[model samples]
Target chain A: MNSKSKIIPWHSRFDLQGITFLFFLLLCLGSFPALEGSGRDLDYWNNLKGFALKLFPPDFSILRSTLQGIWETIQIASLSTLLASVFSLFLSLGAARTISPLWVVSITRMLLNIIRTIPSLLWAILAVVLVGSNPLAGIIALTFYSTGYLAKFFSEAFESADLKAQHALRGLGADQFQAFQYGLWPNLRPIIWSHCLWMFEYNVRSASIIGYVGAGGIGLHLKLYAESADSWNKFSLVLLCMLIIVTVLDLTGERVRKSIRDRLEGKSSLIKKGD
Target chain B: MRVKNLGICVEGKWLIRNLNFTVRQGEFLAVRGSSGSGKTTLLRVLSGSITPDEGTIEKENLNSNECAMIFQDLQLADGATAITNALSGCLGRNSFLSSFLGFTAQEKKQAIKLLNLLGLSDKLNQWTSTLSRGERQRLAIVRSLFSRPRILLADEPTSSLDEKWAKVSLELIKKDVEGRNGSVICSLHDSHQARDFSNRELFIDSNSPENWSIQDVESKKS
Candidate 1:
């Protein structure tokens, strides 16, 4: 299309879209030469092969202890998720711009953003410094990180809920808490359950990793396996155990999320519609 | 409830100016106005959702819990069950914990009875989103009446209803207001409806300088 025909192409190929494509293309090539250096050393390849070879013959001896650690990780995720759910619900309530004061919403949202900006692993290390390498450390780190995400999710959910319903509730003299309870909470209930379940599953994975820093989980066992002489077999076994557990949780979470949807759609509610 | 010198302006244009009205106990005050005449805005201000630029409502120191508005759009919680939506009317009297746990057994029974009365017995468990427009309108009526408000401010409530349901719903409103010795300020497009059910008629004309006026209507003319 020519400019005179009313299809104005802003300088053809070097326009904004083309410039953006070119910029991305250059960035795409940025990692090429550095990535090429990764396979340059033959010795490193041999060591990797050797490392792979050592992770064989499942170590059944530590299976019981590994299961115990797995249980601890589950506990850590559950506790932190419970705490985070309560904290985030209230925070999100206050963060709802349509109800709460602007200054309060801004401060709470900025605080949540700052919390989310820090990685969970770094939070674990920080907690280890504060609480000194225990399950409590894992709980604290995951709670802080999960609160950040859940608050953001819940606030957006609250904002998107039926505004007219909220106004009606307020018009009837329901206070902020009551308004949230009746107005937004019913719609958000299913979503909150789904979000919390997903977060719990995620925290379980993070719990295992944070244990490497002595925060208490199966990852601590993996760390010890690395420190000891050629215990890569046990390390691989621990990873296999985590894989099984995470897979089970992921599948179960899917079913749970499905059930929540069914319930919300009125298949079977507490106040059953007789369906 | 008495509205005194009420005026509301939007976008530097006066929608209502120096409006005055009084609603006595057990009175059904029908508000008549053409489209975009600030009738809804007047009700919104009465319901305390929109603060007027100027004026005051003397509700004898009555708070919002004692007043309810049936919105033009209904504003029922669409994602919730019909029963849940009906029970929401109790939010004014019940605690947040009670609402969270669910309303009291009596509230549930009353809600069920009202739902049945409105021919919504089978829809108790249905989501509000699935209900037809007329059913939802009746549901909004149930919710408003469940609160037992001293003053019910309905804005074109029967717009979506069939002629039959419209009469049934309006009759319910009239019965509820008179039973409690309360008052209703309802807006309507049909002068026949305004005269049939209400004891007073109020016309708000936003385009003119003298925006609002009220006169008495014969009670139960139909």
Candidate 2:
């Protein structure tokens, strides 16, 4: 009987306008008929299936050449990553804001930015034009690219490191390099290894595409096979080789990173036991 | 060491203004101040870590290398072994090449002996992070001794220790410097303890007209 005096007010509005706006957006997108490619059709799917089926039996004739290409690619990536990491290590000291002078930090940062503005693929193209079509071109391109990337990463690492120890070392009259070696290096060792491994993994992947620009690697073989419509079997074999190499590299990188961490932790714990 | 018209300003605020004092050789001068009275700043300036805004400091036989400071925070590298951290004090005295190659056999032996004297013999290879706070403070003292400093600037070196340990730490520092005819200028919050440990005391008051003045506690007591 008391509820009879009460009235419910509906203050919430329906979202009809928002729903309509979304619907209109979808309708406008669907109206662009020219954007639809043949790949969306049944015939395209059937053709792709047949082509994939034909790749089941790969040609073993080019196995030797494929293996050689894989090895060359590995060499290019590994050497480039190694050299880049070292150069970046030195540059990052100047890039770190807390550790370096203002002018040095600004200049190093500008240089890194300029280098990173160019993509690795474009860098490879530039290297090819300058150095000719060789593994050296690929390596040089990767080195330049990796240097910018690793320098930025390392500067961030240095910035994140604790500066109390560095300050103390400086108070003890240590130069910048010595202070970094005794104070910051130990804290940054694990991070440096992780970043290097990640860069190596990235280099390995990018090494494949760099070969398309005539910087020697397995992508050169892939390009040749791609040009011939019936050479899907060879293309598939090359793809398979790339898959195996990438998987192996990923596994190796993980193992190495883990081992480094374990070794550092083990040494720490061993010292703790002495107490 | 003589300081004349020494002034230190941090970010436009004068922490120490026109401070003048002389620390004689073989003198144990205790600096007493309340919190935020610039005791640590004065020690830093004395140790040449911070350049004073005005005036100059003249040392009779001490170079920058001949002075070592035990920071209030005890800045030991946590990732390093206790021995390694202790050995870093020698870096200032050694040539760059020798420091790069690491401690020599004799240097290592000396570091071990210092650590042992501080009762940290069992923790020679221990990571500094794993050591207790008292142990870390002891390690800091040992590290400062490695340089055989002619003048030692200690900023609250015994703050983290109990009464017994504080006395031990102060005694150890006193013994080391007395034997070498060196001097120690340490900051202490406890005035009584300062009087007990040091022959002379320097009092700093940020709010007082005389910002700093020295008193011979022994003379006053006598």
Model 1 regions lying over 4 Å from their true place: A1-21, A38-63, A90-110, A159-161, A224-236, A254-275, B3-8, B14-21, B51-57, B60-63, B78-80, B94-102, B125-132, B190-195, B204-222
> CA lDDT, every prediction?
0.86, 0.85
Clash pairs of candidate 1?
A: A273-B125
i-RMSD of all predictions: 4.2, 4.4
What is the per-residue lDDT of model 2 for residues A47-81, given as tens digits with 9 covering 90 to 100? 88898897878888899999999999989999999
Best by TM-score: 1
Interface RMSD of 2: 4.4
Quick one: best lDDT, which candidate? 1
Model 2 stretches with alpha carbons more than 4 Å out:
A1-35, A38-40, A43-68, A93-110, A130-132, A157-164, A175-177, A187-190, A224-275, B4-20, B53-56, B77-81, B119-135, B162-168, B190-196, B209-222
Candidate 1 C-alpha lDDT tens digits along A14-62: 9788899999999989867786665655687788989888888768899
State the TM-score for model 1. Answer: 0.82
Provide fnat values for all models in the order shown: 0.46, 0.28
